[model samples]
Target: MSVLIEVVTDVAADPGVVFDLELDVDMHTASLRGSGERATTGSGRRRLQLGDEVTFHARHLGLPWRMTSRVTAYDRPHRFVDEQTRGPFRSLHHEHLFAALPGGTRMTDRMSVTAPAGPLGAVVAHLVLAPYLRRLLRRRAAHVKQVAESAGGRR
Candidate 1:
């Protein structure tokens, strides 16, 4: 079974700012500092765009992991999608949505992950991966919100 996770965050920044931050490789690496996540290939220092691919190396669950994802869809300041081309999981899809609010922006993340190893993988994905990923996403979102709301974050 594929596990789906969704998180919503409201930021006191413009939708354009939020969208640009979301695609910033440096910002993503900084946000996941606890995981030691960093881009190893493809777009590293610059922002990712449609048709761009990035390989990320990170330590997760006390193990080193690598994943390569390609941006398959992109609509500036609105929506984007990335799908894993290679990773531990059988499949991973992430969608980012941004909506402009009167005062700021609303950002939403939706992810679907399918593990390998048949039934055992499904059990692990539902019981273990789901919660872990949820927390990870939450932490990342909080970091983005904190950054976007700061005066220095304005573009």
Candidate 2:
């Protein structure tokens, strides 16, 4: 089974700033420090661009995990998409979108992931992966919001 997760965050910063931060590998690693996430390949400390691929190593639920994703779509300051090329999941797709709001930017994250295994994995996807991913995304979003808001808004 596939699990879907949606998260929205409002930040007192320009959409472009938030969008750029979202693609910053250093910022991502910093935000996910608790998980010991690091970029093993591709734009390690750089900002990802079109066709850029990144492989991430992290630990979750006390287990080590690695995932490789490529930027499949890029529109800048608007939306971008990344799909898993290799990972523990059967499939994974993530989209990041930013829109200018009244006084800030509205960032939305959409993630769809399917676990490995058969029917048993479906249960785990629904019971474990879904909630775990949700929390991870929320933490990442909060970190991005703080960075964007503190970094100052730039068009």
Candidate 3:
């Protein structure tokens, strides 16, 4: 079974600013500092764009993990999609959406993940992975919002 998780965040910044920050590798690393997550390969310090691939290494649940994802879709200041090409999960896909509001922007993250081990995987995906991923995404969104609203983010 595939587990789907969605998180929405409102930021006091333009959609373009939020979108760029979302694709910033350095910002991503800063957001998941507790997880020790870092992009080890691909894209380097630059923002991700369509057809780009990035490999992130992190420690989660007391175990070291690595995942490589490719940016499959990009529309700039609007929507983008990244799919895991190699990872622990059988499949992983993430879509990020940005919409302009009166005062700022609304950012939405939608992720779908399928685990590897049949029924056992299905159970784990729904119970453990879903909640964990939701929390992580929320944290990331909060970080983005904070940065995007700051004066430095306007640059």
How many pairs collide in each candidate, listed in order? 0, 0, 0
Clashes of 3: 0
Greater lDDT among 1 and 2 belongs to 2
lDDT of 3 by residue, 1-155 (tens): 89999999989888899999999888989999999998954756468888889898999878999999999999998999999999999999999999988889999999999999999999999999999999999999999999888845432
Candidates ranked, most accurate by TM-score first: 2, 3, 1
Any runs in candidate 1 off by more than 4 Å, and if so which?
43-45, 152-155
Ten-residue segment with the worst summed lDDT in candidate 3?
A: 146-155
- Locate the minimum summed-lDDT window of 10 residues in model 2: 38-47
Q: Which ten residues in a row have the lowest lDDT in candidate 1?
A: 38-47
lDDT of 1 by residue, 4-118 (tens): 9999999989888898988888888999998899895475547999988989899999999999999999999899999999999999999999988878888999999999999
What local lDDT score does residue 96 receive in model 3, on the 0 to 100 scale? 99
Better of 1 and 3 by lDDT: 3
TM-score of 1: 0.94
